[model samples]
Each structure stands twice: as C-alpha cells, then as structure tokens.
Target: MSEAIRIRVTSQHLAESSNPAQQKYAFAYHISIENCGREAVQLLNRYWLITDADGKKTEVRGAGVVGKQPVIAPDECYEYSSGAILDTPVGTMQGYYEMQSADGNTFQAPIPVFSLVVPNLIN
Candidate 1:
C-alpha cells in the first residue's frame, strides 16, 4: 500500500558549530511531512537509524519532533528543523514516524535515507 504521508529532507553542514579536530560534525536538517490520505493524522513518535561514514550506527527514538506532535490534515504539511552530530563528516539518516489517523488507525510513515555531507568532502 502507498504511504499516506510523504517525507522530504534538506540538510546543511554547520561549520562554525562543528569541531573537526574533535571529530564532531554537526548538520541541521529540515523535514517536511505531507499528508496525502483523506484522513487527518497526528504524528506520535519518531525512530531514526543514523549511520556514520565508518558504518557506525545509532538509533534514536523519541516522542514527537521539535517538541510538538503535529496534526496534519489531508493535502497539508508540517515542517521542522533539527540537528544531529556525528563523528564523521559524512553520514546517512533514515527512519519512520509513527502516526495515528483520525479513525484511530496507526501506521508508519517512512523517511527515505538522506545524506549528510560536509561541503567539498567528496570532490
């Protein structure tokens, strides 16, 4: 079945906030979630699998995003920005959002794997 929600991401490296010497790479990501189904849905939780360049993995689980559980109506969208710190300059993030529809049906809205790379790192 097609997903009722669509997810998109845009990421940017934070140079000033990152300490390369300490292997601390910081990136800010903006996520937009659009509801395409006929029913409205409330985002209940999020689960993320983050992988660093060395193949190290970290799993993050939490309630809501940016401190709010947003309710999105059909054809509407919700957007939020968050940050992640990694030991490598390049990494990937993929995960899913747990959602509850108006009728009390729960489902997973998958967020596609997205890259986080420092500029000029892959020339």
Candidate 2:
C-alpha cells in the first residue's frame, strides 16, 4: 500500500460566529481525502488532537467524520467540512483515520497537522 490515502486541509476564521471579547473563536475546516492505492477504502474511525493558542489540548475520537463513513474508490476522493471553537485565535489539529480496504484489511491513514488562525493574527 503506497501512500494508501492522502489528506489535505484548509481552514478559515468565522468572525460572524465568533465573539473575540467573550474569548470565543470559531473556525471551519475543510478536509479532502484522496485514495491513492489500487483498492477502495472505507473510513472507519477518526482521532483528533486539537491545541489552542494557550496550549490547551483537546482530543476527539469518534466513528467517521461529520457523521458518515464514506467508501472511496480508487482514484476517487471524498470531502467534508466541519467546525471547531477555541478559546483563542489560533490552534492546530492533527489526526488519523482507521480505514478498511476492499479486501478487509485495516490500516491507518494519517492526517498531517494544520493550522487554524484568525486573519492578521500572525505576520
């Protein structure tokens, strides 16, 4: 299994749904999962580690993403959008998916670390 799956992430600050004065920061993340192997794969479970600007860490573990366990065919991909709230303007998320191949073999597909930041907060 050569890089069985590829994960890409993008995020944005939802100012409309956030109250900076109240220490509430909202962010929405978009994840794209691409199957790069020779067989189809179904995402079974997900584990996430999120860290806020203040270094507060939160761990999330659940079945599938956003509610569905999608089966992705070879050369195909699935995408979803989800949101998170933090006590600060910056944070990061990283995790992996437990996947089962068409032949009933289970493996882990990792999702690299991605940042969630309010615009102009850095630089």
Candidate 3:
C-alpha cells in the first residue's frame, strides 16, 4: 500500500553576525510533517539532496530528522526544526522523506524546493 506524506518548511533567522567582515549565514528551518494517508506511517529514514547555485551537491543520510523518527497517524501532523550552513547568500533546497506503512511497505514523498536568498545577495 502506498501512503502519502506532506511536509512544509519555514526558514527563520536565528542569529546574525555583527561584524561586517564576517561573510556567513545560518538558516534554521521549521518542518511540519503530516500524514494524510489512511493508516499510520513511520518515518524510517531520511535522504537530503541539497544543491547549491554553484552546482555543489551534498547528500545527507540519517535515521531520523531532529533525532526523532515520528510515527504520524492519519490526519496527524508533527513539526521539527533544523539548520543548515551556507557560505553564499542565495540557494534552494529540496529533498524526500522515506516512510513505511505498518505493513512494511515503503514509499517516498517529494518535498518542494524552497529558496534561501539573503536580501543583499540577489535583486
């Protein structure tokens, strides 16, 4: 059986550098996961295919996001936060969630790409 997973991401500015000489930015993202399926689904693992504007690709594999593999029930949702470090100011991010149903069937849900652009970096 195939299950559907829904996720939403919100970027937050946790802190900023005071010195003008410092060239760096850190973005904290709040992710919400919703199980819209008819049955409970457990988030087994996660795969991140992060791509920068310079074509640099970074793949992150882990057991769970934010140290919790939440099992979302039908029509239920959960939220978590994470951060990423980038040198440049402008970029985008997209990835997938690997989830399995109670019957041990696995499926993937696509996470939409979101922009991360600093005010001064892009027009």
Candidate 4:
C-alpha cells in the first residue's frame, strides 16, 4: 500500500434535539480506505486522537472500525461514516490505521488532522 493516507471529511449539522440547546454544534465525517498497492491489505486496528478546544485530549484505541477487519484488494476501497461530539465550538481530530499486507508486511497510515467548527460561530 501507499505511504500516504487519503482522507476526506464532510461535517453536517445534526438535529437540534441531538445536541444540547445551549451548545451550537454539529457532527459529521466520512472515512474511506483504498488499497492502491499491488498486494492485498488487511486492516488490523485503528486509533483516534481527539482533542477539544478546552485542551482536553482523548485517545481511542480499538480493533477495526465499525466491526469487521476488512481485507482490501488492490484498487479496492472501503468507506465508513461516523459522527463526533465536541464540547466547544471548534476542535480537531487525528489518528492512524494499522494494516498488514499479504506478504506479511505491516505499515501505518497517518490520518490527517481535521477540524470540527460550527458554522458562523467565528463571526
């Protein structure tokens, strides 16, 4: 697999009932993994490093996101969508994914830091 991890994030506003009335916030994300190499790759695990505007940090370590440890063949891809809760109006998240190739080689792809900011909150 390639050394670079391509990630695209799209955040949307949840229903007003989904969040506290006093806090203006929303949740959204789309994670897609593509195997661009010649060999097959199996997702081993995932780790998320979430940071809030209050300087609090949380580390989430677990096996396979959304359950199954998918084995992606060359040119194939898998995608997952999830939501996040943020205490403040703005925050960020970053993490990594562990994967093993068919040849018994393992590697990690770093997840780029994405922002979670409420629209019009800055103005």
Error of 1 at 88 (Å): 0.4
Scored against the true structure, residue 45 in model 3 reaches a CA lDDT of 82
lDDT of each: 0.94, 0.93, 0.75, 0.77
Better of 2 and 4 by TM-score: 2
What's each prediction's TM-score?
A: 0.97, 0.96, 0.85, 0.86
Off by over 4 Å in 4: 1-5, 15-26
What would the per-residue lDDT of candidate 1 be over residues 1-123, giving only the tens digit for each residue? 128788999999999999999999999999999998998999999999999999999999999999999999999999999999999999999999999999888888999999999999967
Question: Tens-digit lDDT track for model 3 on 12-42?
Answer: 5435731224645667778898888889998
Clashes of each: 0, 0, 0, 0
lDDT: worst 10-residue window of model 1: 1-10
* Model 4 per-residue lDDT tens digits across residues 1-123: 546335556666565524656654567778888777777888889888888789879898889888878888887888988777777777888988898889887888778888877677666
Over 4 Å off, model 3: 1-3, 14-23
In order of TM-score, best first, we have: 1, 2, 4, 3
- Candidate topping lDDT: 1
Give the clashing pairs for model 4. none
Q: What TM-score number comes out for model 1?
A: 0.97
Q: Which stretches of candidate 2 lie over 4 Å from their true place?
A: none
